[model samples]
Target: MHLHPQKSLYDLAQQHHLEGLTLPSLLALTKEQEGYSIDKAKRFLAFQGRINNEMLNHQVIIQNPYTAWFEQGDQNPAQIKAFIIQFSVFSNQFLIAQLHKMIHADTLESMHASKEILANEIGVRFQSGQQHENLNNQSSTEGSIDGSRFSFSAAHFEWLYIIAKKLGLSFAEIGQPKHGTHATLFFCNELIRLYGGDNYQISQAASYAVENWAAAGFWKQLIQGLQKYNDQTGLDLPLGFFIWHDKLEAQHAAHTQEELEELYFTQNLDEDAFIQNGNEMLAGVAAFWDGLEVQRQELATTH
Candidate 1:
């Protein structure tokens, strides 16, 4: 599973291009000491807390200019398409790894949560108008996975493989991800294992951020780009990933919000701890996006 990381961002970008990515105008990358570092975890959390508080006061996720650019269809089409494919590659690489590790549970509440998570990971099917009905049938308190059918890892990879082909990428190319992609995967693993047999702590932290504070605008822009790509190319590409996530994540946010609220009142969840976990998770996600941005710029320079 450990493939060699690409040495040159530009070279990696080209590889991605061969896999069906579009190069866009390069943006200046402000050089920082590269590589993921968790040493600044505390400081990053404090900074994120300030930002979160500001958002709460203002009632907005604070629009990223990139989202606006994409939504307006002003950004380079090829670059946007590359991003969509790269993100899918990234998610496919590590998402289930984290989910599998999360299956180990100690407490009843955590066990229920884990089952619910695993069921989702397996992609339980539901008929149209039956999504909520099925979810409601799932235990609200015990968090059971009794009726949920588990999906094979191969089946999931097949989904990714098909999507990549539709987007002009081969399975082999999509599997070879940049360091940033691995960084995101590594962080998820670390978050789950960081608490030393107390997986629930870090899990709550990471989950709360992803399910609550992660930017909605970005996903909205991504969906718009994917739809446009399908339209322009006249291709029946697998856009179910982004399209489903656009809706599912919103519901996820709501569910996690309720979970947090319950924990805050009943479990005496520390604000600082909660914020720290959320921000640390966000930091990893930010690194993933930063990698994509740098690759975009590198690709542009070559073109």
Candidate 2:
């Protein structure tokens, strides 16, 4: 649905003549934690990526060189309806599920903790943007090919530890989340925004940091989280993991390409569109997450 200038989502629904699909259309989905596991998250990410590709393809399909809506008055109603569904809430729904997989609980907990300590190290409040000159010099810089990553400033590790403590995820067996330089940097920048810190804004550099540093952590968490989720959900996650690992190994041995193309489309993405869509998807899904409050609370309580 087209986002109206007045900022209501319903206007487009009416324009499309679909009564059930509105700005506030409710999804027939649940957010129960009993159903949570790493495997489910991974599988869903894979699924949403497919849907995301479909929507992106549709954007290409909907190209209109003509200047006016009136010029396209003869456009199919079904086509317009499909556009509404794709661009509106459905996209958000798909994204939310996909994010739960991408943003692992372990990473969140770790990053949160890391941010807190980093704040102390930098002598700024948590989520503040002041770069600690001393700490910056101390932290060894790491990077990926995109060159978006910066050193995980000393303050960040401190922040992560604190956040992990806040979430009660510090048990030795549970372990702190694995993170790299870029993820550490961007997460802190985002957390500043997320926690309502001063005017610390996200930048294109921050976006690049996220894309560059987060992949390994995400895949690692996806594997471990799915394993635990399998045990909780009574799923064959163990068996799945076994086969998945085996296949990856076998494929590595068999394939002539040193790197697997399927692992990532790395260095080949339209970075602007990729970052914009990824972040927008997160923002859109976040709007609907309040409805999942009950289930989320229950999950929190049980844990």
Best by TM-score: 1
All candidates: TM-score = 0.63, 0.19
What would the per-residue lDDT of candidate 1 be over residues 275-301, giving only the tens digit for each residue? 676666666555555556665555553
lDDT of 2 at 39: 43
| Residue 67, candidate 2: C-alpha displacement in angstroms | 32
Compared with the true structure, the alpha-carbon lDDT of candidate 2 equals: 0.30
Which regions in candidate 2 have their CA more than 4 angstroms from the true location?
1-48, 51-117, 120-137, 140-277, 281-303
RMSD per model, one decimal: 18.5, 24.7
Number of backbone-clashing residue pairs for each candidate, in the order shown:
1, 21
Local distance difference test, per candidate? 0.49, 0.30
TM-score of 1: 0.63
Q: In model 1, how large is the Cα lDDT of residue 28?
A: 12
Q: Write down the TM-score for model 2.
A: 0.19
